[model samples]
Target: MSVDTFAPCIFRMRQTYVTDVVRMHLEIFIQPK
Candidate 1:
């Protein structure tokens, strides 16, 4: 795979993973109130 294509795919995956984690934390800690 080319670096240009691979880099964006990896970046997008990381971004999605981080977003999921942040959403989970918010639901667990902020939803209780």
Candidate 2:
């Protein structure tokens, strides 16, 4: 694949992973003791 196309895919994956980690952290933080 071309570098231009591959770059976006990698960026998107990184963004998705970051969002998922943030969501998981939020969920844990929101849980009641």
Candidate 3:
């Protein structure tokens, strides 16, 4: 649980979360009814 290792883990999780949010927004805009 060192800061060096933990920082990257947090960064990766944030990246994944942001990617999912962007994907969800794209899907909604691409198929607006």
Candidate 4:
């Protein structure tokens, strides 16, 4: 694959992974102890 196309693919994957992590952290913090 070309670098131009691959760069965006990697960025999107990283963005999604970060979003999932943030969501998990939010859920954990919002829960009562």
Those runs of model 1 whose alpha carbons end farther than 4 Å from true positions after fitting are none
lDDT of 1 by residue, 1-33 (tens): 999999999999999999999999999999879
Candidate 1 vs candidate 2: the TM-score winner is: 2
Where does candidate 2 stray beyond 4 Å?
none
Candidate 1 global TM-score: 0.84
Local distance difference test, each candidate? 0.98, 0.97, 0.98, 0.98
Per-residue lDDT tens digits of candidate 2, residues 1-33? 999999999999999999999999999999965
Stretches > 4 Å off in candidate 3: none
Q: What is candidate 3's lDDT per residue for 1-33, written digit by digit as tens?
A: 999999999999999999999999999999976
- Model 4, span 2-29: residue lDDT tens: 9999999999999999999999999999
Better of 3 and 4 by TM-score: 3
- Give each model a TM-score: 0.84, 0.87, 0.88, 0.87
**Candidate 3 backbone collisions, by pair:** none
By summed lDDT, which 10 consecutive residues of candidate 1 come out lowest?
24-33
